[model samples]
Target: MAKQKKGEKAAAGGLREQLRVPAGPVDLTTYDTRATPGFDGSKDDGKVALEGLGAEVSDWQERLFAEGRKGGERSVLLVLQGMDTSGKGGVIRHGAGLMDPQGLKITSFKAPTPAEKRRGFLWRIKQALPDEGMIGIFDRSHYEDVLIARVRNLVTPNVWNRRYDQINDFETELAAHGTTILKCYLHISPEEQRTRLEARLDDPTKYWKYNPGDVDERQLWPDYMDAYHAAIERCNTPEAPWYVIPSDRKWYRNWAVTTLLLETLRELNPEWPVPDFDVEKEKKRLAAT
Candidate 1:
């Protein structure tokens, strides 16, 4: 496949390649929230692929974990940013769920506490980054500083505007330090968001997941969209690229994310670290015992 020029939208191809956000200005309207572009499979095929990916992900994660345990410097951080009801949790449940809990670090960022605010935005975020040889998932990450902070006017324009540079510098540093960053923006339509929110009200089981504030935030849809567009365009870097996953169809969303992650791990090719001790000696000692 030919290389895509900077800011050129992804061409029709593999699922991971198609969903990648091109470098430069991003107009969210160009992406279809409901269409499964690269996936030619049925819903069942998607589901089965997801399930199959789980095992592959688990094996790779174990190797990564072992690599780290044996002093390898490698890790993965998956940043998930989306509107309410966009299935961040679902991706965690269905995709990351298959990995060993010990090797996976998942953090769900909420509103900053008093102390967290005093320290600065990225302080707490720095604390949650995954250690070597682990897979870290950020349910709502530092990008919230740009998205919600910009939309809600939590900070001055000077502060929020500068964050694009700050974030780019931060992620670039992460990439230099052996962390593979995969940032995903779950793209969902306002109409689809409304339907999902309404379903929460109708089903008692999902009531706990509903937040009344989400409805108010929905009122600022256009502002949030603009915020997202700016964020993706400004911070979409070669070190840590962004993938815009169409999320109206939950199955496709899950499948696409899993596939993207699988592809990243495959590229990283984290191998099990070589043993420090002699295998023959250890085997002989065990046999003698």
Candidate 2:
């Protein structure tokens, strides 16, 4: 998709335009996660946008729950795939903060357990699949098998290549079972990532977030980029289209994610069914009792 000009209307024709960024390094701090005109991070405007978006999310969630109670067969699965410092955690934290905890589940996939390793690569992932009337967010998901494993030479090229078909089939099965998969790739530049990493090291409260190994991963940036590009090209399907979110600007990432999720939930149009009961009859029965 071609990059979009800033401040354009967000209709279908404008969607492609929204994805574009200006050439060269974009400033990360100028965008505000809480603001609608996120290009400028005004606190008051940001707060208003955040509150409005939060209210909309809450409304949709309530409707979804009601629809689920009425036996509606709908579920949403959001997969967040990115490099080590790509702000996946931050996006999940802020974008999903407004959701009802009971209706949402987050799964962060790590190195496979021994039992998982013995089974197919997708075995562990299937266990985290969302049930009806819920949203499931996967932090680092099944794509790791095709991406990191392939980049690190942990799997044969043939084995990793086959995972494209495997993942597509898995997602197809989910769609058949009323699950809609929304995948997002947070795209951050190397320099922006370095700044975040340094901030983690400098801030005492965030010291735990600093892992020296993350720096090591930075060395293989090109390899990982290649892996991600290939994985996205091969695995992005009609059942699950991947949205490449530009993350050099953190606020824009948050806004884009929130907007996308809101749009998706709204499209579901979940609603509560009217209860089948006569108020007068109920009142008469209560009076007799």
Candidate 3:
């Protein structure tokens, strides 16, 4: 991953290009959660890079919003999946925080209630979709069906096994209908996760964010890793790709995700759209008044 060009966007190659999970059986074990894959800078330098991207990210988001208002069906949906304390919240707060909230939809999926369970996994997900011309972020997403559902044995092997194909079909439909999907698996080491979770317990203000159940889930790390590996492999397609963000370092995580998104939006090249009305006539009318 090389530095971006000054006046031109290196949308086709660079950090974003390297982060994407290739099409095949992905071994999460081999991915270095601690390695800052594309970034060769210090933590402070990463922070500066992220700051530089803010205005550009906002501009791109506004253009996409305008494109939607002008009748373009295109939009973006970012799906985030990872182990607990993998910095998903940090990404939203720091990365997505740079964009306009009105143009963004953020959904945090929790354990389904009885009513939701009756309707099926994606039922609740469908309702949270971003409107045309909007960008959507899923803090946790539909992949929970295969991840948690499989690990916890909430669904039978035969059932969860079939969900991979179902998810692919669902994403295919969304892509065909004018949505660009970017799914990210935040890669964080177990050691870092423990440190973060412990810090949460130590800070009274952060206590509310900690769930004891997360400790239970830690015991199933190998299983969850397997689940993630399968999910990434089965769902990684040309239409929608998965990017594994090395998230042990929060600064690097923020920089990498923001960089990828900036490249994506730039490639989309959303325009501010021509006004349907006559601009000169409107200007004349205003001037006369």
Best by TM-score: 3
Rate residue 80 of model 1 by lDDT: 97
TM-scores for candidates 1 onward, in order: 0.94, 0.84, 0.95
Output the number of the lDDT-best candidate.
Answer: 3
Q: After superposition, how far is residue 127 of candidate 2 from its true place, in Å?
A: 1.1
Candidate 3 lDDT, 1-289, residue by residue in tens: 2344232234448666889998899998898998786667787877877878888999999999999999999999999889999988999999999888999999999999999989988899999998899999999999999999999999899999999998999999999999999999999989999999999999999999999999999999999999998999999998899999989999989888888888889889998899999999999999999
Candidate 1 residue-wise lDDT, 1-289, digit = tens: 2232222234445556778898888999999999886666777777776676677778788888898898988899999999999999999998888678999999999999989989988999999999999999999999999999999999999999999999999999999999999999999999999999999999999999998999999999999999999999999999999999999989889878987887788777888778899999999999999
| TM-score head-to-head 1 vs 2, winner | 1
Q: lDDT score, residue 59, model 1?
A: 78
Q: Which parts of model 2 have CA positions greater than 4 angstroms off?
A: 1-8, 13-47, 276-289
Per-residue lDDT tens digits for candidate 2, residues 1-289, read 1122343234762332354333333333333322333234544443345445777887787788677677888888988988877888987788888777888889999888889989989888989987778888999999999878998888899999888898998898888888878888787778888999999988999999888989988999888877877777777677777767777666667766776777778777777767668988999999999
Locate the minimum summed-lDDT window of 10 residues in model 1.
1-10
| Pairs clashing within candidate 1 | 7-23
